[model samples]
Target: MIYKSMLLVILLLPMIGSLVGWLIGRKSEKYRDKFNILLTAAELLIISLMFKRIGVEPVSLFIPDIMGTGLALKLDIFRYIFVWVTAFIWFLTTIYSTQYLIRYKNRNRYYAFFMLTLGSTIGIFLSENLINLFTFFEIMSFTSYLLVIHDEDEYAHDAGKSYISMAIIGGLVLLMGLFLMYDYLGTVDISVLSHSMKNIGSIKYLISTLLIIGFGVKASIVPLHVWLPKAHPAAPTPASAVLSGILVKTGIFGIIIVVGVIMNGDIPLSTAVIILGFINMLLGGFLAIFQRNVKRILAYSSMSQVGYIMVGLGLIGLLKDHNAIAVYATLYHIFNHALFKVLLFLCAGIIYMILHELSINAIRGFGKHKNVLKVLFLIGLFAIIGMPGFNGFISKTLLHEALSEAHHMYKTRWFDVAELVFTISSSFTVAYLLKIFITVFMEESEEYRGQYRDHLKKRAIVPMIMLSVVIIFIGLRPNVILKVLEGTMELFHAHGSIEPHFYDIKNIKSSIITIGYGCIIYFGFIRSYLRRRENGRPIYFNPSLRWLSLERHIYIPVGRFLYRSSSVVFKVIDRGIINLVIYLSNSLKSLSGIKVKRPTRVIADLKIKKPKELTRFKIKEEHEDITKRLSKRSMHKEFVTFMDMVTVLRRNLNSLMYAVFILAVMIIVVLGVLVF
Candidate 1:
């Protein structure tokens, strides 16, 4: 019963906070701060209860009768993992937001949207069916779109528009996939279909593809990730924290549910996911190395980190051996990614608020402004790079273990390529993160010093402190993350037999060697390659550099061709449209002026030879109408005179009476009030 109540509270708490925030936040600006505190306390308490109940007992709750739609909410172990990550980050962001959003206007509106997005995110986590998940996913997408475009700048608006367009398409594709899935399987419940014992056709592969592409757009996979860097940087700090830290995880959550729960461990589909993850891992890392902006680099890094999570999911789904370890590592990395990613984004926000600088080069010596923040930033960086004794190292090691186990089992060339690619990607991550650490912290000069001296604040330290402690705690004792994830992975029971040799220590040692080689490549090849000056100075490439040759070669010709083509097309279409509109207007005028009767024939019949005679004839016609009316009765004579006195009113009354009679007869006939 307590667990049931907790589910209700979890669903309703954000909505209540949203209402309370709107009701009171606008009248007093200070009320916005109060709303944050109040809502955070309430939310934290509810989430604490949920964790306690679920962590201790691990119960599942279902309500099948919702709105008579056969919908249900589940609090299973898998959902709980997402719930924990979202809840912890949301709490920290709330504390951070209380101080962060104070300087901005329209505090009330911002908080309201913030609360709405929280509710939507919680809905996504709690949804038990694909339809419900898609519904909540869209809500998460659009509500966050508002937050992204909140600054009302041209860049923000353009980014917001692109985000919505891509998100809507992704949602529609996901819906199509869900419909096809339900049509084939006859159910949308994730748990039911996973164990349903049905023969799936080729459409299953199509479903997997659609779902991956649908979710990959938000997960920031290559080619589909164009909007992420633009959207994250345009949004406010807290929103960016959740967007990077939690929102993208929803896509991973969706993939896991579809593949892990619905497909019942389809290895072929799993192989495809693994390949996509491989691509994401490499492309995300490669692109991140080229970025110069601080948040943009982190944004790209997010794509890469999510790539790691995808790797774990893909491998878990693929390998028959060590499947449990794969899922455990996936979920563990998911939590760690959220914790450290948000820490860095929030810390960057703090720096921005203080220095108002976003470029890495612009904040050359930000380390001098606040020593504590500098340390926190370094810790967050280390966490991301998988430095020893950080949370990232543990999960990454498990991922490598899983990949190694899968490689030996498959022994295919593709597996070898994936292993090599994964190792190389990890090496690049080390090089780029070291570059970030050095550029931000160690490199300093008179020009780089004291650029951000005025923006330091105690309020910014709260979230950093909380996140730093959590990262340290998890890093030192990774068993905490692994144990929780282990509890979650037991639900997916693989049926294949496994040999003890699959888990051999020799293979583990071999993978570690690859990792060592990766590190050496980072230090030896990439580090030296990047550090050496091209022309007696360190080198950087401009984004516009690729256009130089094109500018000299093809730009003028392409521009002239485009101009000529557009001019031709516009002229032709413009003439046709103009002619069409003119013809239409002339036809309307002619129709309006047209008369059925011939006025000349009437005048000839009247035989009016002169102007005075024509006037006399007009008077006679009117008198004739009066005489005909008077011939009916003495009362008719009085009515004719009254009509003559108010001619316009008489005409209007006759038209209105005719309309009313028609309407009355139609209504009566329909209702049988009067018979024909």
Candidate 2:
């Protein structure tokens, strides 16, 4: 009771206190900021106190039937650690945003939504059942939408449109999945479902697909990641930090719940996830290199990082014996990615605010005189690039080793290829980071050097410095967090026997190899031709747009087509059937009443004239839509050939289909032999 009470207070405080921030902001901005900072600080303190009470077993709170479902909340070791992370991050972002948002309007609205988002995110981590998780998930989504569109410009509005579209579609699909799953199981209890739903037949596949789409949109894996790049650049700096830093992680958290628990770590499911992860990783890394906008690069990078985490989730499912190590890697990377990615975005925010520009070309040499921001940015850069002594190094190393172990256990060529792709993506990562560094920091632009000035103050950088310090500290002393992770690993019954050799010779050598490849790519591509040609010349590398944007090529067109097609089909089937029934009934009544004139010929019957009013209305409001006619044409220009795309999809889909078909055939053959 004591633990539950304390836990409840920590979870609910930020949201409830948001009212105070809102009310205060309406009356006085200063008081609102102070109140928000105090609320975050107090929430952190309370969470720490609550953390002290959580043991091996979880502390639980149960509410009787409400909202068509029961509310179940628990504070286990994992939840406690995540809650602690949430409070800590919320506090830091609050402090950072205070300085970041000083010049922006709606300071009060931003602060209010900020706290509301914070509370809902914490609530997600604390939730013990699906209903509880989704309730908070929705609140987090809607409140965060406000944050995304805080700027209220056309760009913000468009980005908000993209963001909300994905969110609503995902949420509705996820809701249907939840309803189906709960109807089948009669409950949304996490513990019971993970343990019992081992074989729900083919419907499990449908449920799984729904859940993945629901969560993957936010996770931004491959075809579903259209909104991230646009939304990140459109949002305010502080909101951008939170969006990349923590908001995406909520989608990831839902994914973990679905894949890890609901699906029971099925091998086929895991394999499918790995393939998607690898695709996103490659595509995101490939796309980031082409981007000039600093925030868009980071947004794409976030997509790839989520890919890394997804890979770990897949491995955990595949290697149940070592689920602990895999789960630990996944959780650890989520934390590190949040840290460095948020820091990177915050750095961008400060740069944008200081110079009133986001284009790397425009901000060239801005970091030359700003040593502190430069160093902090480098720390974040290195952390993300998996440099030897930053936080990302630890998580990346663990995942690489886990992948190696899984490869050893199953020595297939596909695993070998997957490892190769993962390795090269790391190289691509280095190439892009070098591009950002060289363009903004190293390369000199005389035009912008004179125009640009350092405007970020000391207080604005407090968050960056703090994050950098923590990242560096964790890189050096990973055991500090690894110890907590190992405990959480125990709950999953995963193999987490840590050894010194992990960070020793082999992994060190591996890290050196990755960096060496990165170095080669940087000089070979980024430095070799692109920079060599850019000395007071009109030379720019053309980033081919044909395959660069999945959203444009696939997600948007396909999504709109499906939406329109489904609407058309529903209208035709439903309304057409009703209208036909009405016409037939009226004709039958006319015949039965003996009131019909001599029967008209078939041609005459079919040629009934339109109403005079309808004909006049149609002619008066005539419209022409060239684009609609264009859609009737071939979808692709010569460059965007349809057969080419179909061929590629067929190739990839064939491999997956072959695997499933073979697996099914094996099951069938075995069943036949057994029955005979």
Candidate 3:
């Protein structure tokens, strides 16, 4: 109970602080900023304590009969690692948001949603059962949507809509998959089922696929990844950090829990996981290489990183005791990726804030303006590129070890495919990350350099420096991370005594190989750079072409065709309604055709009663005078002109009122919504 209380407090503190900060923000910016800092500190402290506690003893807390979840929470080895990562990244993002959100006017609202997302994300990691995980997962989605649409621009709105729509669909599918799992397995606990039951047969595979797709939306797997580029660029920079750095991992976490824990080691399932992961790796990398927008390019790079994690995880599923090694690799990559990705994003934000531009072309000589940032970004670059000392090297090496060690377990053909894809992805990753580095620091653009140089602030330097240290620390002594990884790796059955040559921990040979290849690539890039420099402008390559993009070729076209089809259907429906109205009016006219003749007998009676003798010539002269007066007046023509004038004025007045009412309503609604 004490542990549970502490865990819950750790999760909810940020949320409480965010709300309090939002309320106070209206009164004082000083107080608001202080609240944010305080909340962040508290979160850091709590997470540190959690790490200590989990390190001492693994704890599991279960609350039965809550939301049909039989609410279960655990501080297991796996979650402990994930929680540590989440807390670290969350803290950095909070610090980043302090400055990032300041650019916007109503910053309180942004901070509120930001903290809300943090709370929900924490809950997701802490939840023991699938049901509770889903609940928090949904809360994270909806609140994160608010962050995505924070800019209130048309593009942001559209992206938010797409993101939510896809998320909801994914959530529903996830729920269905979970319910099915529960019906068959009688529980949705993270622990693997002890024995295979009759109820969970072939359907287990189907449900697993559905669940993967559901989580894959957030994971930003290819074909379902349209929202990632749109959402990240639209979000505030700090929010973008969390979205890429942490949020996507929740999807991966879902996959980890479901496939790794629940499925209890199915070979075919693992194979499928590997195949999809390989595809995502290649697809995400190639697509990222083409993007000119800084954040969007980073966003695509995130998908590629996700792909790396997936490949490691899927490989874990394939081998018996090797899943532990894969998990270790996944964890290492997760940590390394978070550090570098956040650094890059925060650096991008600082650049944008200082320069007010988002294009890479605009930041050509960025390295010259902010030398500190250049150094920081370079550290991130090295880490991401799997330099010998960086954290990325540790994970990639482990992954390579897992593959090579499990060579005997996996089929030769598929194993070769995975290896080839991994190698190619690494090459492509180097190309893009270096391309970004070169574009910003090495390129020659005097115009952007001049404009952005003056806006660099000391306030932004701290976060960058902090992240830079982390990247360097992890890079230099990967053993520091490997020690942490071994704790969790002990849970898997890594039984094969086949100590492959790849597991050789000798640094000198690997360093020589890496340096040799890097020199070659560097020279090749320089030659290419010289050629482009001489030619005036560099040629832009499309990465999406290399990996078949469903967005351009399939999704967009299918959407267009659907829109056109819907429009035609709507037109047909409208025409039908118009025709029905016309028919109804005609029917009414036909029904009222009966007419009555009036007063003929009354006129004759009146004439007979007034039977006095009259002169015919006098009567005829009077009738002629009356007929002449009527002819001169032209009553029909006057009536027609008056009716036309009234009709025009009536239509103009109706339209004018409609326009006024619409404008007034919009004004009120906008005020009410934004202010509220």
Number of the top-ranking candidate, with lDDT as the measure: 2
lDDT of 1 by residue, 1-676 (tens): 8787788677778778887878887576577666666776777677776765676665545666663345466776678878867877887887788777767666677788888888888888888777777878898898889889888889889879768866875776676677788888787776676665246877777776677667777787665676787888888888899999999998888888777777766788777777778887887776666666677778878888888888888777777645877877788889899989999898888867766677665665556545777788878876776666677766777787788888888788887888788877876676566556666667664664655555555566787898999998888887766656545755666433222232246544544565466567556754565444565434434353253332234433444555565556555554454345334434543455332342222121121122223232253464455345434432211212222322223334444545654554333322221110
TM-score of each: 0.76, 0.84, 0.78
Identify the candidate with maximal TM-score: 2
Sorting all predicted structures by TM-score, with the top scorer first, yields 2, 3, 1
Per-residue error for 635 in candidate 2, Å, reads: 67
Tell me the spans in candidate 2 whose CA falls farther than 4 Å from its real position: 446-454, 529-542, 546-548, 559-676
Q: What stretches of model 1 exceed 4 Å from their correct place?
A: 56-70, 447-454, 494-539, 543-676
For model 3, the superposed segments whose C-alpha errors exceed 4 Å read 192-199, 408-411, 448-454, 490-549, 556-676
Error of 2 at 591 (Å): 7.4
lDDT of the structure predicted as candidate 1: 0.69
Which model is ahead, 1 or 2, in terms of TM-score? 2
- Residue-wise lDDT of candidate 3 within 1-676, one digit each (tens)? 6777877787778778777988898898878877887787777787777666676677777766887767677776677777777777777777667776666866888888888998888888888777889999999999999999998989889889878867976786787778787777777766544244324678888778778877888998866777898899988888898899899989988887666666655678777777778888888876776677889888988988898887777777677764666767777887788888888898888887776677765566666655777788787777776777666666777776677656767557867877777766766667777767777877766665555555556556677788888887876666666665655654444333222232256643553455455445545643354224325655344444466555556655655655565556555654454345334434543565322232221111111111112122233343344334334532232211221222233334444545654454444432222222
In candidate 1, which residue pairs get closer than 3 Å at backbone N, Cα or C atoms, i.e. clash?
Answer: 354-455
